[model samples]
Target: MSADNAAVNFSELVNKNKQTLARLKESPRLLLHRRDGEDLVLTTAAKAEQDQTVVSAASRMLSAMARREPGSMELLLDILPEAFPWVRFLPEPDVHAFAVELVDTMRAADSIGNNASVAQMLTAWQHTAEVHSDPVLLAALTQDHGTDYGPVRHP
Candidate 1:
């Protein structure tokens, strides 16, 4: 499900607290935009728990499917692009790899009720897709570099 949120300036929370909260009657979450630091989200406890429950259950189900199906990645390959449009930029094999790792990471993170790593993983993969989408950057990145470079070794 899509996140039901309304974005408002952080000052709104301090100045128009009542009006801001009233917005929550329509949207379950308030994304407070901050100028100085990271933005914060204001959400009801019920919404938070509901989101967690959904994530936890989906992660578990995907994990079980992964374990039960040897060709799970192939199955995921069909859906990954729909969920993450940028996955189309990756090679078929790498897309499968990304899907497998993403599902695994989601299962692990949601199992613990902490999604920091899940967010991190998604950002990293999206960046990877971005780089791959740029032919110049992809060629430059895959070019032979110095010894002991990341993902490359001196033969």
Candidate 2:
């Protein structure tokens, strides 16, 4: 196939994936996870306005993550791992360590703010997490529509 055709296919794939994720985005179950050894509890049904706020914040964090923008690390922390309950089955130590390292790397990248480096870091993160994570869980995390899943930077 020509390069142009490949690009079109890639774009179509991205759109299809986004649409699939959008369909999966609604009514995500909230799973509790301990933060600092204490359970961080949140419920989407608390109030309509609150739910909207949560969704908006999550969307912004994801955009930042995708763009590799500055301050993305802090935004990432705002999202708890429990937010993506699907990963609950994975060993906490592995996920927690990965989250911590991700935050650290994002923080370090902020000092220099190199888009290429940030992109590389995000890719490495995805690969590392995929290696340690269950295939089904990883797919849900990457391909599903949920705040807990972070951003799907795949094409």
> Using lDDT as the measure, which candidate wins?
1
Which 10-residue window in model 2 sums to the lowest lDDT? 1-10
Each candidate structure's TM-score, on Cα atoms with residue i matched to residue i, is 0.80, 0.30
Per-prediction RMSD in angstroms?
4.4, 20.0
Count backbone overlaps in model 1. 0
lDDT (Cα, tens digit) per residue for candidate 1, span 25-144: 999888999999999999999999998998899989888887787787577777888989999898877787787788889988987899899889899989999999999999999998
Q: Which residue pairs come into collision in candidate 2?
A: none
Of candidate 1, the 10-residue stretch with the lowest lDDT total is 145-154
Candidate 2 C-alpha lDDT tens digits along 73-102:
455544645454433444656555555654
